[model samples]
Target: MEHQAIDELPSGKICPQKPPKNFVLLVSVLLLLTIVQLYHPSIFRSLFLSKTIDSNPQVPSTSSSSSSDHSNVQEDDLPSITSNLKCDIFTGEWVPNPEAPYYTNTTCWAIHEHQNCMKYGRPDAEFMKWKWKPDDCELPVFNPAQFLELVRGKSMAFVGDSVGRNQMQSLICLLSRVEYPIVVSSTEDQRFIRWKYTSYKFTLAAFWTPYLIKSKQVTYTEGPTKNGLFELYLDEFDEAWTTQIDEFDYIILSAGHWFFRSMVYYENQTISGCNYCLIDNVTDIGKQYAYRKAFRTAFKAINSLENFKGITYIRTFAPSHFENGMWNEGGNCLRTKPYRSNETRLEGLDLELYKIQIEEYRKGEREGRKKGLKYRLLDTTQAMLLRPDGHPSRYGHWPNENVTLYNDCVHWCLPGPIDTWSDFLLEMLKMEGMRSAEEKKLRITNDTTLN
Candidate 1:
């Protein structure tokens, strides 16, 4: 064909040319893609979207959907992890809780009249509202329902002095919010009291073993008759508790104040020495030595029980806030708030006794492990030391100017700082239960695989 040259169009004239088939198809495909992207953007995003690193080098780069899902998972898991983590519950500050004083002194029947600081007219109500907050993690509030479930079909005994009784009573009062336990057994002296939560088949008992060892009142009728002496049998277990030790699933033992009294020590039915007794030809051992020996003997006795499968807890010495004077010298805890860590100062004896108890607990734990028994130390010393205002002091007794009652700085007021002990105890129980459940699951999985 002969080639012909085409004429150029003018500036205002439009020139039209036939489009190629592939070009038309390409245009149609592009238009369809645009429409699809406008309607459903996710498919386009998957192909084109990219994650950018955060400006701060510390923050890691993450995909949008994946990061969102991860954040949700962490939010859900934070509480579970916090509750299960093994934290130092002893090291904490007292925070105010509006729904505190779990049970009022007037409402709780277990509270003794002497320990009812509120009923006796404590002017400051602020002390009852505070709660213990551990330094590392939040302490779970005392859950009565969970507590009952954990202790169901189990019996727990608090063995030691009145302070031990105080803790037991505090636990009873805390649990009473869920259900009122009936008095299963109580003597006229109330030395041995048992309460039963019938629905749960749980029993809580208090055994009054002031010394945690056999003690006898020795009468001295010779020459210059000194008042009777308290002869403590350091090597022997107090029959009051030993006879019933195997019956309990958990046992909490505490003793300190009773050791401060004038007492003589006996081992193997022989006189060892006397504490603060100035009898001629009798050795006058110091209080620290006697206390150490008594705790050693108590742990030894508990370790000797072959049939006891219960968990044992040695509650550390609860420091008394008898300030400016002795208990008999009109000393009292007059502060209305908890002391800061820097402000608190424990007595030499209090610290020494606490160390001694902790050492004995360690020893007991080592021995207990060998026998398949578990032992725990309830370190409540530092926590209680900060709460000088938690005591009943002059408020524990009825207001009477004529009656000269000693200020009770030794025992804590009901619904006071002592309630934190129960909180700590519940957390420990939960942790222990978690471990046990994990171990059981592991065993089941192993068995199933073998089958």
Candidate 2:
């Protein structure tokens, strides 16, 4: 290679030479600045584009930015389903039935720990621990004052079996506070359990009919027939019930306890007019279907009134297990305190009764909506059965004894499981257009003339 001088030019070309060191340095600095701006956006934006931060404050900053996005994502990703009324095993201990030995004046031997509690139980300290009843088993005193405040000036009737009477007694006790010096009238056609209060005109009554409708109670003697099956005429009973039930404002109807009669009946009037044999509806239409039809008919009759503005509430089945069959094959509720009934152990027959009745009533509600009537069914069956503590069982059977009669029996003691039912009813009543204090005040104000 030939060597060239520091400053040399080709012929006819101006001197082409290297630039100054200062000029080279300036160009290098500019390239370095551009690279930094391109690689780090946050640094570049803060230095060059501060206007973006001022205009939109919602965007994330360097350190605190992640928290905002995390909260928004959580809200957007939440599940839609919600649980409202939770079914739970009862929280309290078992209380023995209060009226267990009403006529005996002593407790039954089964669960009663008291020697004096029952006249029949043998001498033992276990019997001494037994009072005539279970303490925790008694019905908790409900917020009756609040309830009476709600039901005051309203006409309500509890129509059912003796269980209904239990409810009526509790309700009467509650309302009696508002209306002292209570008055009761009883007769064949008209029966009234009333509390007269001058402060607010309110009447609460319970109409007793084990069968809400009428059916003949007949007795028979075995003669020409090898064995006699009782013949109950359900016609005259139903007619009488329909004629009388139309007067109530709000009807609380309950019936399952009465339906499980040991014997069934069929009407037979052929002995007089013409020789003909009549059979029970169960033999013809079937029990489940027949009951559904009858319920629908009764619903129609009740809903046919203009003044009957209140709701028709059906107190669903309250399960009782006196026979060990309902609890377990040989396991009966023999202990003192309440426990959970083994729902998994119930027999096919008992389960069938429960399933059919619930289905029938639920089906009735579906059919009722079409005809412009309202029927609200309250399912207390599972709720009551789960409480093994509430039953008298072996504890309060007789005052002094400890062994309960039948273990699977359904009738519960007063102020027991059924008292909560009244609470449930009050809640339902509020839902079905019962007026509150605020509404009543507004009404009174509106009714007054503005001068």
Candidate 3:
């Protein structure tokens, strides 16, 4: 066979034919583009044709241990489907966060008088310098502007006790960077306070129902008692909140500290028993019994509301760190730093109350799902249990003032560890938003298939 004629050089090196004009132009253009890309690395992200991943990242850890998507955990919570995926964002540690105390007491007037530790002369500021860091993944720092925009034109309520109010105030202060809320209404006792953001048209309210049920101590002829024994009706809803709850778009329910007070618990309008009353022939049920019932009633009221349509978040109990003595007997929390995981653990009354709240929340979640409602678990117990240093303790008031004063171990200081609760709140909100969109898409697909 005759070999094809080949172009060759005199030195024996293979010689190639001259390239076409179009091919030469293409090679020059490719060489120029490669140089530009090397210099301008971010240019590809802006171009749609580039293979940049425009998708969400998987959450670091979950109860289900599924590393693929958040939907696995959320689908587990949906009543429409049977699921085992569970997300546990609450299990975490306190890493050194230099950018904490995002707002000071001066910047946010929402700081209550009882929690104004910095203004009242807190000796150490290190407690406010750290943030909660989840062990499984990095939690995103709270974005107030993003939070406000997410709930624009909606209303949220904090219904339960003072700690719930503490988290609500943290949220308010966090959002103040975007827009400060104005007082729409308030009660004389500060039990019912409503604030509206003029710019965002968002309303935030707190309805005081320490018992989450109808309760009142028969006061003396003189006036109301500060530490009077309460009569908690376990089966009845506290109209203080239930009457106003239907209007809210979001409600955060929490109750823990108040149940620990000296009290009597009732059911079905009859005297069931007393917690610590030592009454004649009245059975002495434990505080946890009342705590459990209070949560159950709160959840029942939410599920019972026929016209109320909204998302409910149960922010589980935040344990108070009263050490050495009880609050009345000069108890205090004076640590300047967070505890290591090995150094402390969540147990005792705090853990018990947290578990009770969760049990009721899960039961209510199942019931609420039947009404096409949503319920979420905020689960701040484990995180806050490590921060005994976060409370105001004796720093809430002037130590030398000639007046009655008690160490505030139950409430948290402003611009302190409690602010992380708002961080958790915002993160949960993002998750809920994603889950809602997914639910809507699924519903639409189901409807189309039915047709």
Q: lDDT for every model?
A: 0.74, 0.43, 0.74
TM-score per candidate, chains pooled:
0.76, 0.53, 0.78
Question: In candidate 1, how many Å is residue 230 off?
Answer: 0.8
List the candidate 3 regions with Cα displacement exceeding 4 Å: 1-87, 186-189, 219-227, 402-405, 437-451
On TM-score, the leading prediction is 3
Q: Lowest lDDT 10-mer window, candidate 1?
A: 65-74
Model 2, 177-217: lDDT tens digits are: 33442454454343334434444455666666665545444
Superior by TM-score: candidate 2 or candidate 3: 3
Steric collisions counted per model: 0, 45, 0
Against the correct fold, how does model 3 do in TM-score? 0.78
Superposed by TM-score, candidate 1 places the C-alpha of residue 32 at a distance from the truth, in angstroms, of 44
Candidate 1 error regions (>4 Å): 1-86, 186-189, 221-225, 401-405, 434-451
What's the lDDT for residue 42 in model 1?
Answer: 35
